[model samples]
Each structure stands twice: as C-alpha cells, then as structure tokens.
Target: MSRRRLPELTHHGDRLPAQEERERVDMLDGRVGVEERACRGLLDGRLGASVFLVRSPGVVDGRGELVACTPEACSRWVRAAAEYVIVVNDVSAELEAAHRRAASVPWWRYVAAQRAFRDWKTIARRYEEVTREAAEAYEPVAREIGRALAEMVEIAAQERARQQDETRRHRSVLAARAFWGWSEVTEAGRRAVYVFRHDVPRDDAPEGAAPEESPHVDLRGLRRAIVDLDLPDVRWDGAALAETERELAGIGFGRWWRDLFHEDFRTFTAPPPARGSSSGRSSPSGGTATGGTGGFSGGFSCGGGF
Candidate 1:
C-alpha cells in the first residue's frame, strides 16, 4: 500500500467568495430579529442555549452543484474569517415560551441572571481579542456559560446578605421607636426620626466625633433596642452602622432613604471586600482578594475571558 497526500485546505480569502459573503451577511441581517428573540429565549430558559451551524462555507463542483467537503478545509475557512452561518427557528415562539417559564422563577432571580449575562458578554469580547486563534472561539463561549452559572450563585448569595441587613435595620428602627415612644408620633414624623438616626452625615467632622455630634443616631438605648429585638444575626457593630450611614449619606439622603428603610433592605448587603472578584466569589475571610477569572454574565457579555 502506498501513502497518499491529502489535498491542501484553502484559506478563507480563497474559499469564501465576495458573493457568498454578501449573501451570508444578508442572511444574518434577515435573521437578526429572530436571533435576538432566540437569545432572549435561551436566557429565559424557553429555548436551550445551544450553538448550531446550518450552513458552512463550501464550493460547487464543475457540475454546478454544491458538494460536501472535509472538515479540515471548513476549519481553515473558519480560521480565515468565514462568517458563521446559522438559523434561529421559531425565535418568537421560543421567546414566548421563555416568558412563560420565567414567570415561575422569582423576578429578582431572573434579573440577577440577566445582569450576569451582561457581564459575561463584556468578558467574552476581551477574551476573543486576546485569543485570536481560530480554534479558540468555543473557549470564550464556554467561559461565558460558566460566568452565567457563577452569576446566578452570586446573586443568590448577595440576596441573602441583603435580607439579613434589612432584618437588622428593621429591628434597630423598631427599638428606637419603642424606646423614644416614637409610635405616638405621626407616621411621617416617625419616619423622619428614623431617617435622622439612620442617615449618616457627610460633613467633614473629625473622625472620632461623638455619635450625637456625628449627625447619625447613636443613642445607646437605640442600640440596646436593636439587640433586644431579636432580629437576624447581622454584624451590626457601631462601626458598621456608622459606615452604612456614611455610605447612604454620600449617595444622598433622599435617594437612599427609601432603600435603607425598605422591607427587603437586608437583601441588598454589599459583598465584603474579599469577595470582590468578577466571578462573584469572595475570600474565606475578610481581606484583600485577587480578581477571579474575569468572567461575567447577563447583558455584560463581550469579547474576552473575564
């Protein structure tokens, strides 16, 4: 038996004709509306997130008919800038299905997942630029999928923290009201008192100023009430309360006032500094932590890995 040499694969420039490029671009444009619908479907779980290639670049034989070709040549063209060919069947239908499915999940969960998807897009774009090799396109896609998963988990964790914070704040507010006979006041006045106590001041006061002088309510009776109320176990030390008030004031009293007093206020707890990675995982203890693989999800998807 004699060994045989395989035919050389043509580069994208040679294989994909201008006419084909125009046709593919036109097809893609036509499919844009459907593609968007399909993407939404996948995000909403109405349609599974899977990549499919309906047509790949190829050539016609002398008989003037298209013919199947080897994967090697297809791979070459893909590397050489061949446009991805795909079809999104029933995108609108799928989106409707997804909308129905999404109704079962908590609205916040859906919103969190969407945010993660956005982050993943941003990270994907950067990954694509860094890894320009033809074989690496799938890597970025996989990374994006991973980011979406991680984001879901992170959102859940952050939600828990927020809930805890809200519980603590609620109790503290109740205690303050009880101790000061604040319930006797009108609802508006009671709210004002709570806002005055909880709202951190933004003036350039000395760092160690007394609580009363610091423009934040630091009544010992209020603190005792917060502890006695038997709220969820939150790390509500004097320092943390002060910091929270300061952060709230920095943003503006009116804007964050409602947020501070919201029933689910605890669910919006900020992640500790240690868990500040793009992946949404935090360090075991509270200290500086390095960025995790820069992955994101939701509307943030882009060209790179992080």
Candidate 2:
C-alpha cells in the first residue's frame, strides 16, 4: 500500500481544536529553559507490548535570564546538539482487538467480551503477569539505550565545546576592536576596525606589555573558520536503530499474547520530549505510567529518521 504523507507539525498543536491547522515545529525548537533528551520505551496509541527509542532535539532555556535568541529562532547549537535514534511501536491489544471485533459487528462497540473468565480475579492476575513479563524482557533494551545515550553524551559535549569556542572567537574580535578604540561609542556610528594588534608598530604596544603568545582573532578569520568548519554530514544510524528494535522484539516485548502493537515500522511522531518528560516509562497495552505516553509515527528503520 502507498504510504500517507504527514502534514507539517507544530509544537503543542495537538492541544488545538481538531479543526485547526498549524505549521510544523522545527526539529530543534530550542526555546529557552528547555534541556536535551533521549528516550527508549512504550508510547501511547499502540496495542499489545512494544518499546520505542527516541533522540529528540532539546531546548536551551536560559531559565529566568533573558535569552539572546527569539522564541521563533531555532538555536544553531540545538541542531549541533541533536542526536539520531530509531523507534519501534505496535498497536495496543485493546485497539487491535477493537479492529478485529469491529470487522464483525458495528464499529461503535469495538471491545467485545472474550470467553468468560473462571473468576474476576483471574483477569487482573493475567494483566499483572503480562505487565511483569514485559518489564522483565525490556531490561536489555533499556540497558542498551543507556549505553547508547552515554556514547552520545560524549559526542554532544565535544559538539557543545566546539560551538562555544566558535562563539567566543567571533566575539573576541569585536571585543578587541572596542579595546583598541577602533569601534568606540562616538556620535558617529561605531567605526569598523580592520587593524590587528601585530599590525600596529611596536610603539603602539601598551607600555611595558610583553609580546603576545597568539594573535587576537579577527572578524575575517572568524568568518573564514565559520565557513570552513566541518559539520557532520549524516543522520542517525538507521541500521543501529533498527538493531536495538530488533532486540526489543527478539526479547518478546511485542509478542506478548496477541502481539497487537507489532507493525512493519513506526509512524512519524512529533519531535522528542523536552527534558522533564523526555525519559519515562509506559506499558504496551495498559498500566500505570510515570509520564503520559506521547505519540509517534515511523516510516522505516530507527535512528530518528522520517
């Protein structure tokens, strides 16, 4: 069957009335005071037992401080900070049963009663058993997620440092220009300073100041570096993302009883969670959850691809 093309998404657009249309939110919606996140687990709107892995972009909330960037401006750092991931999902048992049951009877009453239980307690007992088994099987996938996040954390740190240094270099030239009286705050607009410290004659050196170890960076140099800086040219590894998911199914999270949640691939989900709700637990079928389940859609393999 041909796949459906998803429309643009917006942050919190789900809260809008069903009739309202909105734009898609940027993958890196770096609003102030938000933090980065990585996740692996069950999501809402699915049936049976299934687990998902996610590496959504995080925000740079300055907290209470006034931020330099506008709410509409996505942070370049956020994109640099973004990581790739793969996620898997399935149809929930209740929903899957609803689908099959609806095929026979009116679509309105999807939940039909199965064979009568020997005792009412038996039903609750069975649910608890299914939940327990799911939790047990998910341990390895969870551990793998931890390992993956750790690896990504190291990578993020390096990226953050590189970006910060770039920011500092760009600012350094401006600061130096002001210090040298080239970009002085005068009645005339600030003057542009193209001269460097070394270009000035020795007599121009500050009295008694020793020679410098390195030249103060210039705007030209900063611009050149900005242009030449190597950006990573790949998305998250679909194969690797697919592998963890393979382990999840191999471990039997999707096979509990009916395995209703099982699908060929996931659908396009909204962007990953903000830090606070980013990482939490949920059940494949139904059970208590720390954070409410979020929605996701998958087209192919994992690693945070469309």
lDDT of 1 by residue, 183-272 (tens): 111121221111123343423222222434323333344333433433332112223334444433333221232343321111123322
Question: Distance (Å) between predicted and true CA of 162, model 2?
Answer: 2.6
lDDT of 1: 0.30
TM-score of 1: 0.19
lDDT, model 1, position 149: 40
Query: Which residue runs of candidate 1 sit more than 4 Å off their true CA positions?
Result: 1-48, 51-143, 152-156, 166-170, 173-179, 182-306
TM-score of 2: 0.26
Q: After superposition, how far is residue 130 of candidate 1 from its true place, in Å?
A: 28
Candidate 2 — number of clashing residue pairs? 25
lDDT of each: 0.30, 0.29
